[model samples]
Target: MPGIPVTAPDAGKSALRRRLLAARAALTGDEVAAAGEALATRATALPDLAGARTVAAYVSIGREPSTRTLLERLRATGTRVLLPVLRPDNDLDWAAYEGPDALVRAGRGLLEPSGPRLGRAAVTGADAVLLPGLAVDRRGLRLGRGGGSYDRVLARLEAAEARPALVVLLYDDEVVDEVPAEPHDRPVRAAVTPSGVRRFGGVEEVEG
Candidate 1:
């Protein structure tokens, strides 16, 4: 093992993800809650989501920048909110979010919508897709949790020629200088933080 070089892109990504997750785990409940509120306010006002009729988002677990508030706010605005239901193959199957009561417990400590499965392709109809990430670089490269669920979702959208506004939710500190990126890794259009919204690409120009 001494002579082995561990410079592969995936290795670097795993290390970065661990560090970021550790940092997030250190945040207090109050800190995370406050950030979630701010994110709801800032994101709801963003042009990318302001006119969106359908949004694909997820519920936050642990110390991740909470998406619960933003999801509720989006729903209150008459936006059709969809939540992911993780499939056995590690792919995401989406369903309509019908308020907090409709969320049922799922594996991996996740809360998923208990509505009828809309099939994996349902996400293609969303006007915007909110992704969960441990961190994002200034160039918009996202560091996911290595599950590759969102990767499949992105690919599905691409295959359908669907152009949706891609966004990530994170704490302000999670927006860093750089993150290792690979050729197939697509950059998100923007990231919403508690402080404000960070734009990296043409989020406003993405068509529904």
Candidate 2:
């Protein structure tokens, strides 16, 4: 979990993303699939999601810890799941998840929900948000893919004075000791790994 040596935030983030993405790419398909199942179990059990009516989530692609199982489970429980639709400017526009069949292949190795677009402000109404990230530090600072998509989501929430629980899904090893923090980088409230969920800040652990 050594952070990049560069002083610039963008430089540091680029280096970290390259390293983490390479490591994830090295994982076997079987490993990724198993991790996805475990992640689904751990994520669903989080207390933050207990009574959530609407959840902002994403569809995982390639070596990223998969969200297919988690999305299915959430939908089955009658949770209003919203998946991201990549916008022209790279900002995310959300839409209702109507199961796997509703997903359409998008550029940059992404699968997006094909439902009606719910404007950018839709994320602020979610009871919880499951973010995609390369790694998360002990402080809950998440290292995203540098697309600035989730950054906009967070900024919108802040502007609206929303307090939805922010969470990141990752493999166990992706939870690191530290990651370079920036002024705009928002710390997550919790992280769900294959083993279990871990709380940060003043967040409390979910009881089994």
Candidate 3:
């Protein structure tokens, strides 16, 4: 019998993700914080967010910089924010978020909103969906934390007729030329980094 053959793309992506994670872990808290601030500044300047009312974003974990500042800025600008709640079925459940106090520690050390759990209708009303990923490519492909949670939720959102512009936040170095993409991996519309916001598969240029 022949052994299972690993595809070249899969192997390359695995190696790249490992290297990226290792490099990210080497950064100090202050560095991550500063990078996050810069990324947020660039993100807010994107035209897609100009009239966005409801936004869906994630709570960062570990060495990943926190989105607290961005969330506050959005709220102050009258944007209704939603955060994900990890369900027992390993799927994402969403809830309305007001501030940091609305979040509590959940399973796997992830912070989730403690407010009213919203349904698919609320998600479909969002103007933008900010994704969390280990890495992203110039093509908009996202490499998540080995979990299909975001993919599944994004699929659901699409099915609900929610065409919110998808965006991913990443470090400047995490933006690569390519990433191994699976069928279930939904590509984001744009990416925000310390360098600036880049539109994937779009004609928008990163302004200086």
Candidate 4:
């Protein structure tokens, strides 16, 4: 939710983002709930998540695939969960997820962890990162809201030389053959959809 808005030069990407957001907004509340549960089931089974001690994830807002269920499941399994806090500059800061009760409403009508702030660099310690996206290409390029928050997150990880498994959560249809790519966009290792988990090139294979 913290990505910067796409500019005029990104007209094409902007149009696609609007279309996808509109389609997501069309889902019924019940449909979103069911998809969230199914996505959690599939995501929790990934070996990347299964072995993770610290996972960098975010609270799903609006019609996005819900990370709420997945967050709780990760905590239940003794994993330390980190959620993002939006910085004024649109960069993301980190905070530990204490549970649903620990969440507080913040800017742009989104929920954020109500815990001590962990520096932006804190994400470098993650074993995996569950990214939010409107769509991901087979090449694992994630199309995030123009806000650029996760873009900074990825850059931070790269600067720190962290090699955490980067995973995206989306509905089954959001996995496309391709999306508009940018020079700075980093490829994700995998995507977890309600239908199943899909791995891309350079990703580690998850065992059944």
Q: Residue 207 of candidate 2: its Cα lDDT?
A: 24
Per-residue CA lDDT of model 3 for 1-208, tens digit only, reads: 0111224654576676677788789999998889878877877777777679888888888877558778877888888889888888778778988788878998999988888788645667789999888677656788887777777778888788778999888887777766778877777898787777777676544544
What stretches of model 3 exceed 4 Å from their correct place?
1-10, 202-204
In model 2, the worst 10-residue window by lDDT is 1-10
Q: Write the per-residue lDDT of candidate 4 for residues 156-192, one digit (tens) a residue.
A: 8999999999999988777665678989999999988
Residue-level lDDT tens digits of model 1 in 150-178 = 99999999999999999998887777767
The regions of model 2 sitting more than 4 angstroms off are 1-11, 202-208
Tens-digit lDDT track of model 2 for 109-198:
899888899899999999999999988876789999878899999999999999999999887777776788898888899988887777
Q: What is candidate 1's local distance difference test score?
A: 0.85
- Deviation from native of the Cα of residue 84 in model 3, angstroms: 0.5
Q: Residue pairs in steric clash, candidate 4?
A: 3-147, 3-148, 4-146, 4-147, 4-148
Candidate 3 TM-score over all chains jointly: 0.89
Clashes of each: 0, 0, 0, 5
Candidate 4 lDDT at 40 equals 90
The estimated TM-scores of all candidates read 0.91, 0.91, 0.89, 0.91
Best lDDT among the predictions, by candidate number: 4
lDDT computed for candidate 3: 0.78
In model 4, the runs with Cα more than 4 Å from the true position are: 1-11, 202-208
